[model samples]
Target: MYEPFFEMTNTPFRNDIDTDALYLSSDMSEVLSRLEYAAARQLFAVVTADVGCGKSTAIRRFTSKLSKENYEILYLSDSKLTPRWFYKGLLDQLGIESKFYRGDARRQLHQQLEIIHGIYKKHVVTIVDEAHLLAKETLEEIRFLLNTKMDSHQPMSLILVGQNELWDKLKLQHYAAIRQRIDLKCEIPQYDLSQTHEYIAAHLSYSGGAKEVFTDKAIDEIYRYSAGSARAINKLCTHALIYAAQRAKKLIDDHMIREVIAGELP
Candidate 1:
């Protein structure tokens, strides 16, 4: 609705936006670099962030850079995942039937991974999202699964992505085993005020807007409401754009941002 009003090619602050359009902030670049290192070494990595802080966004970027010929990617995001189903989920992606029992399923998965690496020459990258919500038993099974070949190596590059609470959970003595197995850990922090301003600016620029449509005061308001979370920044800016277009406004000020937030944002 606001495309013509804003003179944009399309709506920019959207979830479906391409990975190339993601903001390559300094911290994000570092996180991506570390993730690549983990993948190359077939290590265990954990990435945790606050809700809406761009954990999934970073993962999308990292996975997008991997070459398909050299890497087989398996992704699972199930909150209610059990140990048996965890192995089954990975096996299903590998196009193999999993045995009914947990131990059998685990062995089957290990054999499949060995073949992929030793014969097919492709490294497997397995990512489990929403891991913070997984059962303690399921997480424990992960440690066991990685104990391969006299504990000398792991079969795949395993990444666990979740909210910061995932780290808090891992810190507990109950999860010490799982925590010890993590070879690399990445924590994504929310953007600061400066990043928030640049973030809004980047979105507007991506939408093909040349001039500053949002006043500095308006951006300050956005930072206050969004508190530097990328998702919140996108949502607030998109709403502000729509509201401005609806009112035939050419510029957004702090007052307009306030009105948009109260009326359009939750």
Candidate 2:
């Protein structure tokens, strides 16, 4: 309801992970560095962050930046809770047949990996998203798969992505071995003040809001209300814009921002 009135080319605050609008804050930069280092060294990596902390976005960026020739990657986004389901999913991803029964899926996967290792000059990488939901047996199976060897080369590089609760889950003594295998652990912290501003501005620019639809005070209030989370900031700003345009207002001020928070922004 606000595009033409505000003279914006697009909506500034869609929730999708737009890499073009990616704001490289200090914590995000550090996470990227750790991920890069781990991938280059072919080490196991664990990337955990609170929900809406941009873990999926960061991982997508990392994967896109990696050299395809040097890495054969299998990325599993929808994860199952069982070891059998996980292996079957992997096989389906690789376009390999999972004709074997669930009990034989692991062996078949190993055989497939052996073939991949033989043919591919670069490392094979498997990234499991939402890994915290993985069942104990599934996780154990993952550990075993990572332990495989292929003529001195490690079986594959494993990158597990999950929400913050993953850390607590890993703290269990029974999961110590899997935790130990994680060569690197990186957390994606919420954005800080400066980062929050940059993040909002970035989306504005993306949505053609460079003419200052949101005033300085309005931006600050957004940061305060959002608590520096990109998702939260986006939600507030998007509605704020709609609220302003509906009122035929040209610039968003503190009162307009208050209205947004008060659920009075139509």
Candidate 3:
């Protein structure tokens, strides 16, 4: 409804943004670089962040940049996944019909990964999102999966992306084996004040809107309410734009953002 008023080609602050247009803050740049290194080296990497910190988005960006000829990226995100289903899920991604038993399925997965690495010369990168919700048994199985030819070569790059609880969970004695295997660990920090402003502007610019549509005071209010979270900032700014348009306002200001935050706008 507000696109024309704002002279935008598309709706800004959309959650499902194109990875090509993603804003790369300095911290995000470093995280992506490290993740790329881990993937290239076929290492076990763990990325932890608070909810709405853009962990999934960063991973999407990373995968988008990978070459299909050299990397086979398989992404899985199931909070209630079990050990049996975990193996089945991986096998499904690998285009293999899983065997009846869990052990058989695991062995088949390892073999397929080995073939993909050795014969096809393509490194498999497996990303497990929401891994904090994985069952202990499922996590144990993942550790064993990483044990495939550990003495010689690593066949696949495993990246576990989850909320900060995942990092805490790894600290437990029972999960020590998996923790020790983590070759790279990274976290996506919440956006700082300046980055929050840049983030809103980037989205607006990407959608062909005037980057200065949001006033300085309005951004301050957004950051105050969102606490530097990209997701929260997107939501607040989107609502603010709608409210501004509804009021026939020329530019989004502190009053519009305040109204959106206080739920005063209908």
lDDT of each: 0.91, 0.80, 0.88
Q: lDDT (0-100) at residue 15 of candidate 1?
A: 73
Q: Count the backbone clashes (under 3 Å) in each candidate.
A: 0, 0, 0
- The segments of candidate 2 whose C-alpha lies over 4 angstroms from its true place after superposition are 99-103, 150-152, 264-266
Model 2 scores a TM of 0.90
Q: In model 3, what lDDT does residue 168 have?
A: 97
Writing each residue's lDDT as its tens digit, candidate 1 over 1-266 gives 98898789857898767788877788889899999999999999999999999999999999999999999999999999999999999999999999999999999999999999999899999999999999999999999999998989889999999999999999999898899999999989999989887877777778886458889999999999988899898899888888989999989999999998888987
Q: How far is 93's C-alpha from truth in model 2 (Å)?
A: 0.9
Best by TM-score, which number? 1
Cα-based RMSD of candidate 2: 2.4
Worst 10 residues of 1 by lDDT: 202-211
**Per-prediction TM-score:** 0.98, 0.90, 0.97
Error of 1 at 142 (Å): 0.5
- Cand. 1 Cα-lDDT: 0.91
lDDT of 2: 0.80
